[model samples]
Target: MALPPVLELVAPHDARPPQEHPCATGVLPIRRISVSIVSLVLLALAAGFGGGLLGAWMRATPPAAESTPPAAVEDTQTRIRAAVDRVLPNIVLIVAETATGQSLGSGVVVSQSGNIATAAHVIRGATRIEVVLANGDRRPARLVGEDSPFSDVAVLAVAPQGLRQVAFGASAALRPGDIVLAIGADRGLYGAGGAATMGIISATDRILPRSGVNLEDLLQIDAAINSGDSGGALVNLSGEFVGMITSVIRDEGSERSAVVGVGFAQSSDSLRPVVAELIRAGRYPRPRIGIERPDEQHVEITADVANQRRLPVPNGALIVAPAPNSPAVRAGIVAGDIVLGVNGAKVDFDFPMVNLLKRLPRGSRVDLAVLRGGRTLTVSMTAEDQ
Candidate 1:
């Protein structure tokens, strides 16, 4: 075998009388160095070309898709738009002249037969009523009936043809974080026609106070419901009406602001039966109970034991006194019993008895469970309509 390749550095020096060199007989060859240098250059060129090919391959490849599917995003958008379109035509702008000037609100078309549902406050003491259609047609409207002080819904009759009516949804099944579409006039700022806003259900079963009545079963939404958006449709993704946008939270941020988006609606569940009653009788039926509470959710009690007078129980709506002609007194219910439950359900403090009365049918007897001292007693009483 040939010797391994040698690496050598040459040095220049003054030449002494040169000794006879046997290396001349073994002189180094230049061809070997040239071949080595050429091999190294070729190796570098091949490595450079390989690196360039790898970079090109990476650049040509496509990027991976987003984690969220495109179809899901599109579907949500489609549903939201469709819900708005279906409810917008049914949303009517209610204009009334208050003591100040013009007041604005929203209303939903409940009858293609020309009846519209709105907040009672919108038409309170109004001399003229106008129904503005989504097609820009304004027609004269008349207040046929209203359920005030107990409910805020009012029915208006108009002569316009082809008015669309919104389909109602079950408000009892509504849960928080559900998407809802709100459609109404931006106080007519979006022109004579209506505008639509999209949001989610923020809360439910809320109690709100109206000027004329106590509104119950309120729905909280993030939709931009304004002063003029009252009586408008709060529709779900299925395009079914759920509630009416009655009021917006202002100071407490319950109303929609640029910073906080909060809106409240009177649930259609509370208004539907009332509206039907108003339409039929010109007044909504009020359910009556014998007990009165100083505060909501608590019942008052006072009792006598074996001809001995007992102390009065405070902090509850007492059954101490019953109506002279009331159902409780007629059903043989005695004073001094604390009402804890109605119809087998616990009573709430705020409008507790009122809620049970509304739900129970007239002339139907409900079992009221009472707490007397440490024992519980169930009293059966026939409920009455007021």
Candidate 2:
């Protein structure tokens, strides 16, 4: 039998048929072989490039440092040191000897002509006064003028020639949180090489009440102020004097207790005009109303007395008595009348009648709102010099 007819092997459907080459028998063309070699090289290159990219993406990066540069820290220290150097020369230690004992304080040179600004209480009732300069030279000082009755400021005269005076900055430009340096003698122990305490202003336009005194519009700060630090300089970062350290608030729990970081300063803006007047005329020209209210109790009586008299409001400046031939008498203000305002501004504990009059010019004509016999009336008066 044909026995499966010699069982011819069949090629699969997907198999490619072999073609005859045009070149010499059994050898491929040179162009086709070159293309095949180039294709293989390209495939190898692509694979190598992909593997290298993947490896680079999986690698970890180094972290950055968080330390500050040493040079920047040093620059800040240099600036603060420069500011202290510029103002240290103007500070002075004041010593006043009275009949009872000696008092110590601090002061700042305000003029090249030997004018100095200090606290009035420092030189009060002094038989002799001395000032020690930054170079340890002690000089005799004399009271030029003082405004202790109303303000705690005072001016003194010394014999310093060609002395460096402090550069004053505008206190009106100061705000809460402004950095300040309080420079003063340490309990008058150190010479003019005073100590410095730094702090920020806690409040502005603060009113501090004292027995028989009114400290209005004060600058409150947290600087360390000792007893001798009164009248010391409160300076800005630019080496300009902005305020005068007046007093430190002690803890009221006990008379012997001390409180740290609570002090007050008088604004230099208010001191400038007073110092100028003291230098020129030996006294500050303040307006007076010629009415006396000795204490807070007397001032507070306006409220009670107004209720008894059935007045419009209870809070005002109650007149105890008007001086004979004074401005209050000339304006028809009697003891029974109450001053409600000055120049349309209300009279309160902050802006008391005396404080309002002190702000007016000596020859200013002020309109006062008075409550008399349950009627609010306007009274005009001219301010007089104190």
Global Cα RMSD, each model: 16.8, 21.1
Candidate 2 residue lDDT tens string, 1-386: 12356565987788888876678676778899999899999989998998888778667544567677889778756766777888888888999999999999999999999998999989988999999887778899999998755788999999977569999999888889988889887665743478888888999888776643468768999987887988899988888899999988878676555665589999989888888899999987766656633342224335565678665665677776677787878878887677788887887756666667667867899888888777899999787765
In candidate 2, what residue range of length 10 has the lowest lDDT sum?
292-301
TM-score of each: 0.58, 0.65
Q: Per-residue error at 7 for model 1, in Å?
A: 62
lDDT scores for all predictions? 0.72, 0.80
Q: Candidate 2, 8: how far from true, in Å? A: 99
**Candidate that would win on TM-score:** 2
Clash count, one per candidate: 17, 0
TM-score of candidate 1 versus the correct structure, residues matched by position: 0.58
**lDDT (10s digit) by residue, model 1, range 1-386:** 35568775654476476687545757546886689889999999999999899899888988877687889989989998888878888877777765667777777889777888898878887878787777778888888787654566889888758888889898888899898888877678768778888888888998774321246889999887666887888888989998988777665553433445468888878778877776677666655555532233223322332124444333223466676767677766666666767777765444354455567766777787776776788878666554
Candidate 1 regions with alpha-carbon error over 4 angstroms: 1-66, 98-100, 210-214, 252-259, 287-349, 352-386
